[model samples]
Target: MAKLTKTFIDKVEPPAEGYAIHWDDKLPGYGLRVTANGVRSFVAQGRVSGKAIITTIGRYGLFTEEAARKKAQKILQDMREGIDPRAVNKADAAMKVTLQDVLEAYVGRPGKLKASTAAEYRRQVEKTFAKWAPLPIASITRDMVKERHAALVKGGLEGKKAAPASANAAFVTLRILIRFAMDEYRQADGTPLIRDNPVDALKHHWAKLGTRTERYIDRRKIGEVWNKLHAMRGEVQGYEALASVDLTIFGLLTGARRDEMATLTWDRVHMDDHDPAECWWHITDRKRGEDLQMPLSSQAVALLRSRPRLKLADGTESPFVFPSWGKSGRIQDARAPMQAIGEIAGRHLSLHDLRRTFTNIAMRECLIEKFRTDLLTGHKPASDDVTSRSYLNLTRLNEWLTGEVQKIGDWIEQQAAIAASKNVVPLQRSA
Candidate 1:
């Protein structure tokens, strides 16, 4: 490239076809180019601070000489300030999106969410997403992510409001959302927009301290929680409706993750699809990662049918077994109904506790055995035999797992009756 002094830019002219300068041209950041294509592009003379830093300005007539000089001078100024021009360009390139925008796109994406599960994301978004929303995409550096993550660990959402586990949930949400952007978007040069996500830098922190979402609540007090849920009353249903009944019962019976049960569609549930000797729920991908096919008991089916034809805004039957609170034919906040039940029970118990309760109850029931029980709970198998159990040509395994879940359901229902005996008087049926 020719010397890019003020005189050079003022008096220098382009060649008939291709322009070149003797000082230096081909090396990046060394020279400017005004190709026959009429594009006036900048080519920096050298790397910035030993890091390659080559960036383009604009087209020839499209970007005036005066405008190009200003941008060039700014780049030089940044270099003088010990701010690598390459880094500044890289940083500027990454700021095309914001943290808030990425998260909203993720949670609001149309698929696989039970109304209740989606609502939980909404709650998380409302609380944490807002705090980081304004941050530029590039500004969401490893340091920023680490600072927030450390705060979550040291105290959780401010000194001690959310648990470490809850804080981790927030982190996971951020990681997945940011990752989505990196995998999806690209730069003007067609390079990947984000080559690396800062979230990956924090994986060690997360791995050493297991995810915040999976803390196992103890079992001894779960019975108390069960009793409370059985005794609680909903507003309109008072202490009596089946909708309220199914909410508490299903959680305890299947040991399926809470949202997994909430998003159940009758079509996915085929209780009558099998012979009496072989009933099934035919559960689908309730958890995001794997394909789960949970067989249902007659009791599971009964609990499911207990709230058939969910409330719809148009007053017609809604497709969802559990409609969205907003009447979008999706489930409303699943945690809300379960939480209400807990509040009524006077325990403030979480729905996840119901899963723990299911595990405990299953442990007590030898009818289902160990690995089979874990299968129904969606926990990974303890052995190869257990892993292969679901794949067996079950003239019996299908019926067997369904029977196991049903047996556990029966045990839970019986205990629920006992718990409610002292609380809610109207026991139309057991949990």
Candidate 2:
């Protein structure tokens, strides 16, 4: 046995093979284990409930002789009380796992997270929880989550603008990550390291995210908004701008989500110039995790046809219909163009608003059946509707869907023409 002072521990030679332990003459169970690989670790050895236990406290340099001695004293005390030091060490480790470690593990599981979803998780971590990422997961508390949520709502973090909606979303992502941590990490006693999600402190207090149901382009201004998008495409300088404008138009015409439209490839498109009714496109990796095949209006087919198949520097045409020079190989947003269109529409608008507009046109203006309209807009049937859920296969009704989309498309053109002619009137109920 040695006194386990820094000088003595550093001077001790490793064994020729296997390993050796130099026990502290001053502390009963405290010792340094030196392996043949030149690794030295602080350890505590004792008996608990008539069984022997040897637990590595930590590595040598990470804990000085004094610190390791104090830790070893605690471990020895626990062992004398019939508590397993190994379990205590494991619980300590579990509690020290950082937020970043949990997120990386959560997103890294095979086939567990979609690419778009994983990207959003990364964004939330970087933008909303960057300060918390390096902290131990167990250190995030109920009060911390509440205070952070309030701070996020008021635009106080690094002078970012008020983002109530984003704040709500951020906390939701936190709740999910915390739940995953609870399931994954455990104390040696078989209890979750995270017993309660700190986000639950906001149980009844989540900020109300504004509903987008009423945010679609007004029927009266559809033409003006459409024409403005077209004019901007011509005036904007870059190919990226052109792709963005077209993406916005395509989204409005087909009622597709922004990401769905942005990621569309040429191979998913089925078109026939000779037969307008045969034009359709398919989405494989939709948010609902279901494949969607939609009948395209003639306007949509024309827009797709106009997008040039420009050869890239790699001598291959980009797969994305809305291609971009960015690393994504596709345009992620039409923010500038959407803002310009919103100026014409008389309100702030989003890509999702275009989907709502298409729905309103199909169901409200054209009097399409709710079931068929839902099909056109990629909505699952109402949960209580057994017939639609079990019996109906809406995709096979392509002819009906084709006619319905054309009706909405034709109405839009008429409205645009009326506006272009400077003869815009209140939309008539009879028309």
What is the lDDT of every predicted structure here? Answer: 0.58, 0.84
Off by over 4 Å in 2: 1-13, 22-26, 48-51, 61-67, 82-84, 87-96, 135-167, 182-212, 287-290, 382-400, 424-431
Q: For residues 1-431, what per-residue lDDT tens digits would candidate 1 score against the true structure?
A: 35555465545566678755323332234456655444446544444566655556555456665676677667666655556665556545556677766656666778756556666766666666566776666567788778777777676555763345556777787777778878766564456667788877777776243332333333433445555545542333521243444665667667766566556676666556447445555455445325556766666676565565755557766555655445334543344445555544444345576676677667765455676776777666545665365775422335557666767666655655665566657537867
Listed per candidate, the RMSD to the true structure in angstroms reads: 8.7, 4.2
lDDT of 2 by residue, 78-113 (tens): 899988977776787888999988889999999898
Q: What's the TM for model 1? A: 0.60
Clashing pairs for model 2 are: none
What C-alpha root-mean-square deviation, in Å, does candidate 2 show against the real structure?
A: 4.2
Q: Which 10-residue window of candidate 2 scores lowest in summed lDDT?
A: 156-165
